[model samples]
Target: SLKIVFNFQAGFGILANMFLLVFYTFIILCYRPKPTDMISCQLTFIHIVLLLTGGNIWLWDIFGSLNIENDFNCKATFYISRVMRSLSICLTCLLSVFQAVTISPSSSFLAKFKYKLKKYMISVFLFIWSFNVSFTSHRIIYSGIFTNVSETKQMKVTKSCSLLSMNYIIRALILTVIISRDVFLVGLMLATSAYMVIILFRHQRQHKHLHNLSHLRASPEKRATQTILLLVVSFVVMYWVNIIISSTAVLLRMYDPVILSVQKFVMNVYPTITPLVQISSDNRITNMLKHIQSLCHHIFKKR
Candidate 1:
């Protein structure tokens, strides 16, 4: 029953995410996503995929049984969900790097590489997909159609299967790579955000800056920078909290289901929260609301 409710909630969440993605795409299409806007669009698209994958898994788990007839569907569902979740995490790291690069100062050598790298975005995205697919194929090896016997027995029966021992060193290497990537991107976000804040502060201190203050204050680029800063801060805080808990659990070799559940919840919640944050702050949505109000008033006058 709880699982069913979770699926329903996830479905609603995915719907909301899709609506936001479309709205943002429209903004990008009409104006077209600048190279910078492309980062947000890609993140939003990945986020939608993550939510849909999760929701489908839950829905199928509740409503679709794992029979031989449905075994392929089950495998496909799990595979796609795992791939999408991993891709979302990977793409988020890319998004941070992309944004940081976009805002890099012209004096910085890094800025010179931006034009060269601009053409590689699609290629990079394709690489991300291929990387995730290669790693997540392990799901196919481990999961299969299960046969359940009399009230208490269930088996992950496999056909002529030889168990391959897990290489702890290899697993550790993969984990280290993921963590290193996250840490690097987080550091970049910190540096870029700090630079932006310092620039704003210095501008505020200039006495001659007063006359142009209103214009500077209303600059879209500044607002966008501030928004990215907020995202970076929230991501760092939440991610570190999870990291601390997760590292402790892994080091201690704690296998308590409750602890595992909490860890999983922490992972899911971040993506769920992001769309809400974006919608709550979207000025374009507010402007659309005002436009709707004006149209209503105009209709009433015509009546």
Candidate 2:
């Protein structure tokens, strides 16, 4: 049952992210996209890589069937997975900050960032990718094929890849850095989310009062802000839950298969749900889908 559940989540997540990948690419190449859309496109791509690397998708079994397994494969897989996971949080935090600035009033200090975001968005993303890639590079040194299950110093990440123990001081320093990064990014996401919520409320209140209207629908900015808040909330909840389970496993020396399976499920949940949420809330995608459906219906009726 556990295996079945894990497969279901992994399969569904990959498919969802793949769809968004193509959709986002089309929008980016063929049309003018909102700044937030570009961030989301990159986030979507990161989710795809995370699902592919971190979720494993039975790669261990395939490697075994192929009769080829080595430290390089194990190390490369985990290293890429770690980098993608780091990128996930960093990009999500960026998304929240940009949305907050995008929705800020023209006179507000945050509004200045809106212009800078457009000018330096790609540079910011490149920096994030480089930082995370460097930050998690230690995985290459510490990760390898697990040859001895009895070795308590190794923590199993996948069926084949395990993290070898490092020097006590070095391990402690790495842990501190990772914890600091996660905390800082999560806190930033929450702060920006709160700011967006406040701006949204103020806008609604003033909009109603000034227009003498009570049943107004959400504006485009309001919808975009709400979508981002949802993403931030969901990402935070999943991150903490995964951290709890993985931290517990680490404390126990990371030998438990049950705990590992649970951790994978927890990790996959956020990526699986993220793209679905974005697709459903995105008016452009929804309208495009509707257009396709209508076009298909008209052709079928004529036939």
Candidate 3:
């Protein structure tokens, strides 16, 4: 039953993320893409790749069997998954910061910074990838298949792909690196989101009369800002919950299959929900879907 559940979750996540990737590719090719849209497209692409790679690993774990066994598979899966997961978090943080800067008052320092950042957005993305790859390189070096022996009188051998043993110093270093990276990215996202809220609040207070006159009116930027804010909030909540569950499991040395399955499910919730949130919040995508539906209805009526 758990295996069936995992398979279903993995299948759904992969399909959903793939749809998001295709939709964004269409938007970029057919429409004038904004900086935020570009970032979102890239983020969606990463999510698709991550889901493909990580989902396979989870499936293997669920089945408890593999047709082919190799150390390379273990290393490749761990390396790609770690790098892509970090990249996903960093890209989301970039999205939040980008939206905050976009909504800043024109005369503020953030507005000037935004213009400069826009000029080097590609460079910034390159830097993020390079930094994450470099830091996550240890996964490739320290992860491989390990052989475990049963403690019974009749020794039984079990081969599993996981983190290989290392010296205490090296282990500590890697743990520190991961924890620090997560803290920095999460902190940056929270700070930028809080700042954006403050700026929006002030603007609302200052333009209270204008807002009253046009109560239902919201600019595109405002809508985008709200969407991104919600995405960030949701991501933060899922991230922390996953973190707590994972940390507890690790600290307690609880390696039960059910516990592991729950952890995997928690880890996947954010990516699974992200594309849905993006599609529902963006008016263009919703409008495009409505247009297509109407066109199909008209054609059928003529027939």
Candidate 4:
């Protein structure tokens, strides 16, 4: 059941993310590229890579093949996946914060950032990629083929690649840094989410007296903020669930097969649900799908 669940998560997640990535790519190219769309496109690409690496879709099978016979495969898979996961968190946080800033009231301090945020997004992406790569480089040194020794303890990540133990001081320090990073990002997301809620509430109060029905339709900014808030909430929920499963495994010093699989499910949950939520919320995607459907229908009629 665990294996079945994991496979479902991985399969569905990759497909959903691919669907969003293509749509976002088209939007970026054929239309005016919004900052959120660009960030989401990049994030979709990152999730695809994550699904490939950590999603157990290809990495295990590919590395298990005879063509690859070294610890290099293990190091590369864990390191790359780790980097991508870290990047995903950063990008999600960026999206949430960007949306918050996008919707800020004109009189607020956050309003000052609204104009310049889009211009510097690419730079932010580059910096985050570099930072995560460097921060997770330690994974390379600690990941290798699992050697079964009855007397020795190890965290078996896969049939082949496992996490070798690190020095106490080094391990503690790295764990601390990683924890700190997650906490800070999660905190920022919460803060921005709160700010957005306040903004939305005030927006309603300010507009309450007006008889105009025009405000009934959500503006692009409002829609974007609501979508991002949903994503941030989803991300935070999955992150904590995955962290709990992982911490439990680490504390007991044994990665039970069930626990590990649950962790995978938890990790994949966010990526799988994200695109679906975005697709449901975005009218543009709905229109795009409708356009394609009508075009296909017209072609069939002609045939």
User: Top TM-score: which candidate number?
Assistant: 2
Model 2 segments more than 4 A misplaced = 157-159, 210-214
Error of 3 at 303 (Å): 1.2
Per-model TM-score versus the true fold:
0.72, 0.94, 0.89, 0.92
Q: Select the stronger candidate by TM-score from 1 and 4.
A: 4
For model 2, residues 1-303, the per-residue Cα lDDT tens digits are 876787778888889999998998998999998888799889898888888778565765577788657998888888888898999999999999998998899999998878888999889988998898888899899888887765777877666668898999998999899899899999999999999989988887778765755667777788888988999999999999998998898788756888887788888888999999999888888999999999999999999
- lDDT, each prediction: 0.62, 0.86, 0.78, 0.84
Off by over 4 Å in 4: 55-58, 65-70, 149-153, 211-215
Give the poorly placed runs of model 3, Cα more than 4 Å off: 55-66, 149-159, 211-215
Better of 3 and 4 by lDDT: 4
RMSD in angstroms between candidate 1 and the native structure over all alpha carbons:
5.5
Minimum summed lDDT over a 10-residue window in model 1 is located at 154-163
* Candidate 4 local lDDT, 165-243, one digit each (tens): 8899999999899999999999999999999999998887787787475648777777878889999999998888888
Q: Residue by residue across 81-120, what tens digits does model 3's lDDT show?
A: 7888899999999999999988888888889888887899
Which of 1 and 4 is ahead in lDDT? 4
The ten-residue window of minimal lDDT in model 2 covers: 55-64
- Candidate 1 TM-score versus the reference: 0.72
